[model samples]
Target: MRILTVVGARPQFVKAAAISRAVTAHDQSKGDLEDVIVHTGQHYDESMSRSFFDGLGIPEPRHNLGIGSTTHGRQTGLMMNALEDIIDLESPDVVVVHGDTNSTLAGALVATKRNLPLVHVEAGLRSFDRTMPEEVNRVLTDHVSDLLCCPSSTAVDNLEAEGIVDGVHLVGDVMYDVLLDDLATLDSMASPVDSLAVDPPYVVATIHRASTTDDPKRFDDIVHALTQVATTIAPVVWPVHPRTSDLVGGLTVPDSLHLIDPVSYHEMLLLVRGARTVVTDSGGLQKEAYWLETPCVTVRDTTEWTETIDAGWNSLTGTDPDRIFEAVDNSSAPETHPPLYGDGHSAGRIVELVRSLPH
Candidate 1:
């Protein structure tokens, strides 16, 4: 069976690494699986693009659309057209997409129109809010998918609640697989400590979403909260997102904060692994910090990954400075390590389900 895989964002790339490895391993054993990787170029920056595949040892994509950045409608429309063309040429048995990126939504639409089976990894995740574009994408993709591979029981329940009963399988999280594999590989490499210019016990702050960092008040609140933390030696190291950096340019950042360029996935993984604590609005980073046994402070109002909170490893502080400071101040060092996501074998299960499907 031949499969067409779509990846466009940093998180998508990370998820794809596990699937690609699974496909490769299956091909070696069964001698029938073939995977064609397509890069949608949603995250076109070099540091975000090439470094992930390099660090994770994922194979190079068969096609790079080079779509770059654009308005949401335009980007998805372009990807839909591009993916339709590729589907026509490759004619794979199944088209696989990961998570809720625009690329995943576009690939699902194209596959649905073509009458090809769609497999959505990380399906059935819901924050129950329509305001987020990712939530919209997840709902649409799940509705159209032939197979909904859910990472957790909560996701399966969410899909059933939304009346999606067909093809929902609890196939663990592919992100867990990727994280375990990469951590084992990269832990021996030199730490990213010196590059980030922070001491060993510093908190790593990452803000990417427009809602948290673009809004002036919210951004200032986060900055103020980080400044209020009474750490004498360890500074808060923030690898600023390009969008957040552009919006907050010329604004006064606290002297105790060290703002650096975004690092590669491997470097970020190292930072997460070694950090005293992690503060972020990123969903992926929240799970990553949990997997790495690092305490986390989530800055968003809501998170789809509630398992992290249930495990008592992460806290939701929103963007309020007082709440943020309170959460941080009240948070003690994390000692509990729970398998909130899965047992780090989601990739193999996903591949097995794909191969077993009627084509």
Candidate 2:
């Protein structure tokens, strides 16, 4: 089985890593399994892009589209134009896309256009807000995917309501699979937190969403709230995203708000695990925080991973400064961290499902 996997963003790299490992194992044991990766270059920076491949052991993409920062429509259009040819040349049996980024939808469109089966991992997720770009991508991808592997029951419920019942499977979260595998070796890896000069019981903040950074008011409010947390609760260790690098320059950042360059996936796992609380606008971070059992304060009003909130592990505080600061101070998770996604074997299950699909 030849599977063409399309990945663009940082989170997608981690998910792809899990699937890649599964494919390697399947190839060794069962034979005739190939996982071909295509990098869309949505995350353009070398630090953000190459480090993930090295850190996670994902096979380098056969094609890197280099579809860097642009308007959403143009970026996706460029990816589709480039990916269509790759699809034609490679002639893959199944095209698999990871998350709800423009890359995901672009890959989905090209696969269906070529009349190939499309398998969407992390499918059927919804924040129910049509205004969010991710929400739209998830809906469109789920409708077109031949196999919709959902991470949670809520995601499956979302798909059922949207009238997508066929080819839907309750596969566990691929992120969890990667995390579980990493946990065994994480202690041996050198800690990034120590290099930051930050002590224990610190808050980790990752605010890169357009909703927070593009809006000046929200960005300023988030900064002020993070400063508050640093002053009162704990120091905020923020790894600035490459997209947000320019915007971070003009701001009057305090010393307490330690703004540093992005770290590798392994470094990130260590950072989150040691954090007193995690504050982010990123969808992936919410689940990572929940998995790490670290209290999470989402800067957005709604989250696709509502199960985390329902379990008393996460809180929604939008861009309100008071709420953001308070949520950090009062951040506390429940006693038991029940495995919401699945055990460390989701990648194996996904491989089995893909094998069963009629080519």
Best by TM-score: 2
TM per prediction? 0.94, 0.98
The best candidate in terms of lDDT:
2
RMSD of 1: 1.9
Q: Which ranges of candidate 1 are over 4 A from the true structure?
A: 195-197, 230-234
Per-residue lDDT tens digits for candidate 1, residues 29-81, read 78889989999998777765777788788888999998988888899999999
lDDT tens string, model 2, 108-180? 9999888899999999898989999898888898889999999989989999998999998898999999998
CA lDDT, candidate 2, residue 306: 94
The superposed Cα distance between candidate 1 and the true structure at residue 338, in angstroms, equals: 2.3
* lDDT score, candidate 1, position 84: 83
Clashes of 1: 0
Give the Å shift of residue 254 in candidate 1: 3.7
- lDDT, each prediction: 0.85, 0.90
Model 1 per-residue lDDT at 273: 83
